[model samples]
Target: MTTVADLAELVRAPAALSVPGDVVAGATAARALGPRTAALAGASVLLYWAGMAANDWADRRLDAVERPERPIPSGRVAPATAVGLAAGLTAAGLGLAAAAGGRRATAVALPLAAAIWGYDLTAKNTAAGPAVMAACRGLDVLLGATGGRVARAVPAALTVAAHTWTVTALSRREVTGADAALPLRTLAGTVLVAVAATASRQRDVTAALPVALAGWYVARYGGAQARVVAEPTAGRVRAAVGAGITGLPALQGALTARAGAGLLGLAVAAAAPLGRRLARKVSPT
Candidate 1:
């Protein structure tokens, strides 16, 4: 029963900690320049949901191929309805971004929408998919940073973005058992870990270790997926889980200064079990 309704749950997928993380990261960065970041943080969540809905709508076809049971293709949700929903989400997100940072912040909203559309329509098929995916995460973070300290935060966002890119690729053919999914996921994780090791000068090891462990498990498990995706919905939700793993380090990093960070770590550490429960509850089939 993890029908198209289940796939539609993705409307809230990107809105979770990923959006919160971006808002916090952006506001923290922008605050360096002396701005009230609370308002910015609030708007970011709206934008995140909007962006995700647009992405889901754009990728309806690809999802249909990889996930025939999804809303748009499964007859549970109309394609036209999904498109209209995406448009509404986009408009709302743009308005929120505009209100949050005026023209500078609002400016990125359109690009973000374009990027989401582009990725759905074609990026996943091109070699540039990885780069574009990575860059997209970085750009979203930048949108948040516009409120406080833009320059200082860009590097960290870029760091996180690189990891995100790898996860995106991993969730693709590699994690979906696309014949070459294993090697691709391995290489992507390896490159990301290697980059982190070199850039953070071993400090990232503590965080990198868990990700490495996850990658190893991914390598071992091949492309087994979440049970919630109707028929074989694994591919659609596979990449969705990447957020929890890649975010582990930054959460750890945040722990050094804030108790909230430690709590985040706890949340991420429990993501697998939680996701399992969610998958089962949503997909009950």
Candidate 2:
């Protein structure tokens, strides 16, 4: 029989912890935070969870061969049930977006959901995989900026997308390990992302929190990439991927702080270490 633990693993419940801050950073950057921010955050988490479920469902056959301990392959959850959950969550996420921010939010949510499904079903093994996954994350950030201030949120969205691309690229090698050069390149990209994130905001007393948080984000994520660069082993790659996923909240928090939501940004950043702690109990990847 399937227990709640099985479902939690299926959806990567701990990883979902990294998702809400995407919306918070976007909404704060767009000056769009309102009653809808909470709703959009919830919608983002639902969509993220949906993507995780869909990913397992689409990879069920492959998992049978390589990851037999997974929910579907292990017989702890039916394939059909996993797909059904993905579909249901997608619909619910779209509905929440629509209800919270009307047509604008729905517009972004539709494409976001489509990207999630596309990545799972057709793009997972393609060269386009990392880009597609990054787009999904970028759209999730934009979902919170649909309140007529989307243009203002572009920088935050792009920062999040760039960070996601590096993470996804590393994730591709989690099973087989990567060439040292690949992680070295990603490490360079991480530095550029950190520079861009910090430079985008004005330097002042108000910039202090964002700068510090962005530095923290860089240190944590960059440290993981450095490890992979040194070892280039599957275990190191997997650890880097997990760190990337869980460390995202810190990046988001930095962006949120850059947008003048320092306190709120700190609150969001707090989720990262918390997510890491939870990952020890339940795998985030």
lDDT of 2 by residue, 107-174 (tens): 99999999999999999899999899989989989998998599988888888899999998998888
Candidate 2 local Cα displacement, residue 106, angstroms: 0.4
| Top of the candidates by TM-score | 2
TM per candidate comes to: 0.66, 0.98
Model 2 TM-score is: 0.98
Q: Each prediction's Cα lDDT score?
A: 0.51, 0.90
Please give the TM-score that candidate 1 achieves against the real structure: 0.66
List runs of model 2 lying over 4 Å from the truth. none
Clashes of 1: 7
